[model samples]
Target: MLIRSSTPEALRQNNSLSVLSALRRQGALAHTDLCAQTGLASATVSAITAILERDGVIERLEQKPAGGRGRPRVLFQPKRDCGYLAAVRISSDQVQYSLVDYAGRLIDRFEEPRLGGDGATQAFGQSFLAALARLAERSRLARDQVLAISISSKGIVDPGAARLVWSPVFGGAALDFSALLGAVWPARVLLANESLLVAQAIAAQREGQGHIPAIAALSLGHSIGLGLARRDRHGEWEVSAPNFGHMQHVAGGSLCRCGSQGCVEAYAGFYAVLRTAFQVPPQTIPAKFVPIAEIDKIAAQARAGHRMAIYAFRQAGQSLGAGLARMMSLFGSMPVAVTGPGLRFFGLMQEGLLEAFAETHEGRLNGVPLILPMTGEDELVFEGHVTRALAEMDVMLATGQGGGAP
Candidate 1:
């Protein structure tokens, strides 16, 4: 085992973590590259790599041709089978779980229907655990081999306390999943809001790219969520004010499921956009149509250039842009990444949103750029959870904990 009680083991763990992190961030790094990236001696890098390779945590790929003179250098990549982590994303309508490798690739995914309303607490908890157990069993990963488990939800999570402080979807009461899951699986667990994890993932991808200070992310789904990043004096990425969705946007737009009116989510959320697009009578709208099928149909029709569909999406974009303008003014404008289902309508709302944003801004703040829409899978939140869990593991290893056996 890589873990030991002696000082030698601590040093080994630290060195291994540095090498692993280098490979993860730079992808197939050479020995020299690892040394330079990690500020470790060449000999230390070799020793760590040797131990990691012996443990099946990393492997050397084919050597690349020499650039000019010297011998060709061998590159290393993370071994996918070494271990895996589980990423769970819980929302109002469903719970999604994935088995992700050390390289952050999701190898398998599982989702279960969510129990809605106040009665969903116990039901969702049981179903979530069962789904996780099934996924782990099917994937052949043991409980101890799960380096860590990170959960992302549509609410504010107090990680230190291991409780969800408040979730519009779960009501205001704090939901303690740590205590709940601890009884089932013994593993190092971290919990955070889906939006915050999404932001962390974005920041991790953009790290050292000179775009850290100006990067921001917006999650558009059943509810709108935002994540902002800024660089500290020490030149480290820091997340700020992750839960910024509850701010009221429309004074009299519509009543939210949380019993509030005029919030941005009330107008631009997945359900809100669907309700607006379908023109369904409020009383007649079915439960299933709110978050899934209706929004999907609208996306498909908008893609087909249906007039009403396009108009409906444009309206959603306008509402989103309006709320975003307020956020930009308060947070100082930055390069915004609009993600999630909302990006499906980026084409329909791109011009309108930009126009609305432009109409509101007086002048650029700190030369921060305008919102940059990113279109990708809804599984991004799960991906974020994986990234965060792996990063935390990397930190633990770097600090001499090896991979905790919990």
Candidate 2:
């Protein structure tokens, strides 16, 4: 929000944000190039850069000789040591941690098994706090050096509270990360759905001209997750993770972990495929967790032309395709990017997926495009955390609100 009348100070802050955003997006740039890209006057650019350098948010490079006749010129870029960011990716099996610098470079990372015992949330919280301490100690960074801690999980996130409302790992047990981490770390605590981060990374990657304005990132694994990223009419990036995995796929069908019947995840999740392949009763409660090796074995069997194995995959694909159809109907036809470890089985599900997709209203009228680009899921998630974390940090620094609670 802006003032009804633009004040000189407000204009200056806005211009500073613009310059930082330009540099962050395009890397280092010369003063003239910064003015050209930001559409700011040369004088304004100089003033902003001078303040940014003085604040240590940005730094100047060694002067480079002009190609021909002009005097030597200097480039400006975000200072690598300005602040640090930590990314924590929580999955069903394990929790992964990544440390990144202000320049968005990965500094270090480690993973630990996500043990589940009594008081699962409390246990995870203790482990998370310890991990943060370890990260800071190992990296030799002071407590205040960390600008933000962005955490992602496969679950329902209360974005307003930076909390995990529900997750497969700890169903119905809400974890208020903002309050939990705030007690220990002074850095900003942020929470997002894992799939949403995937969408963010994909959106940032395609920010170049001529790219799609919106996209849907579908993460398939033991559970399914959906993240949609789109630019509003004002061209501001908005991202969200809908509980698409829990959307009903078949009424009164297989039981789901959420105590519901016929949810999309009940049919398409790894456990569902296993249950169907093994001829388990539809009413049987799903396993709390299904191992990746079990799913891989089923994939192998499906590839070997085993009728039951193939049928299980087909059923899962049908559920996914139907869910995607309904989603496109509501969100318009946005290209979907399928990711996660489960993509390895895409070949087995392609037939049923495309077949069911074609049967949908949007599929018939709009023809949904499915894009599968090869990339590491872990890397994408981390990149997404960094992209959003750093961008948020820039807004804070520019607005003089850095290190404040939301």
Candidate 3:
């Protein structure tokens, strides 16, 4: 195996990290290919690969015979069982938790009902810890194997401080989750808003596919959430400013639950649509309607030429697209990803949303790509948390810093 006495600053700071990250995104790669991709010396790549294999972070696979090469080139991939991380997504309607391996694969998943009304925080905290314990047991993973526990909440998160700044869905107050979980769990805790995490997870997965200048993700659920990812001047990936849901869409269309007038959530959120659906004065409407299931039925009816359903979806989509137009203007155009419960009605709303976007967008920014209905098996928020945790671990290991304390 090749060896190096000292690694370059960039390589030392992110040596194995850069290599592993490249492999994670591109799958198995040969040593020469890694050096070419990461701009590291051939000796450095080999040494780093050896270190990673020794630490169980990566493993060598069988070499493919090359017709012209003197010897076959060895390939390497991330060891799927290197360790585990916990991902928790806290929303107004539910709490979803999962145990994921280093490769962002779900090992187990658990979900619980969200506490309604004002006293949801304490109830959610208790349920969150309980669910985590149950999930760990189910996955048969030791507590120590859990290198980190990352949470994605509906509100703003200060990753540096590991605290919630404010969330309209949860009471408008900063929550000290680090202190709260510290009293119970024995693993490093990380907290980020759901929107940012979603964007990060998507970017992490899409790395090296091509030069995607920027990506935007819009989540349509109980509350509207937006995540934006772009590379900064220094060539570092950065998550943009969030809280796009609160942006005004109409002058005085509807009252938002956040005590704002004409916000996007007032028209695009799950409850907003359901409230409109229930107000149709139907004498036989169900007492309780599941928004997702009901929305699908409504979309199907709209497709079949139901005027009322079509009208409602159109209005909601117009309002949503207007909000997106504002984001497009500020970000100077990029790919917009529409996801979550709202996408179920994409067929009904596609035209209205496109029309509204065209009407509101001032410039010729329409050429920007837009991704609709995010495609992935695991919950995007949960996968995002797991990705963040694993990336953090990689950084710490490369820098020779110990893992964060519980």
Give each model a TM-score. Answer: 0.78, 0.95, 0.81
Question: Which lDDT tens digits does candidate 3 get at residues 79-175?
Answer: 7777677887776667787888766677887678876555456766677677888888897876766767888777667758778877864657667
Which digits, one per residue and each the tens of the lDDT, describe model 2 over residues 1-406? 1223378887888898999899999889999999999999999899999998888889988675866556667899999888889899988778888899888899999999986652388888889889889988899988888889999999899989898888888888999988888877878888999999999998888887575778999988889999999888777679999999999998888999888999999989998999999999988999888888999999999889999999999999899889999998888878888888888887787788888999988889988566564458887888889889998888777877664221
Each candidate: what lDDT?
0.70, 0.86, 0.71
Clashes of each: 1, 0, 0
Evaluate model 3: give its lDDT: 0.71
Best by lDDT: 2
The residue ranges of model 3 lying beyond 4 angstroms of the native Cα positions read: 1-11, 54-56, 61-73, 115-118, 184-186, 204-209, 234-236, 277-290, 296-308, 361-371, 375-379, 402-406
Model 2 residue 71 lDDT score: 68
| Local error of candidate 1 at residue 157 (angstroms) | 2.2
Candidate 3 lDDT score at position 337: 74
Clashing pairs in 3: none
Which residue pairs show collisions in model 2? none
| lDDT score of residue 394 within candidate 1 | 68
Candidate topping TM-score? 2
Judge candidate 3 at residue 71 and give its lDDT.
Answer: 68
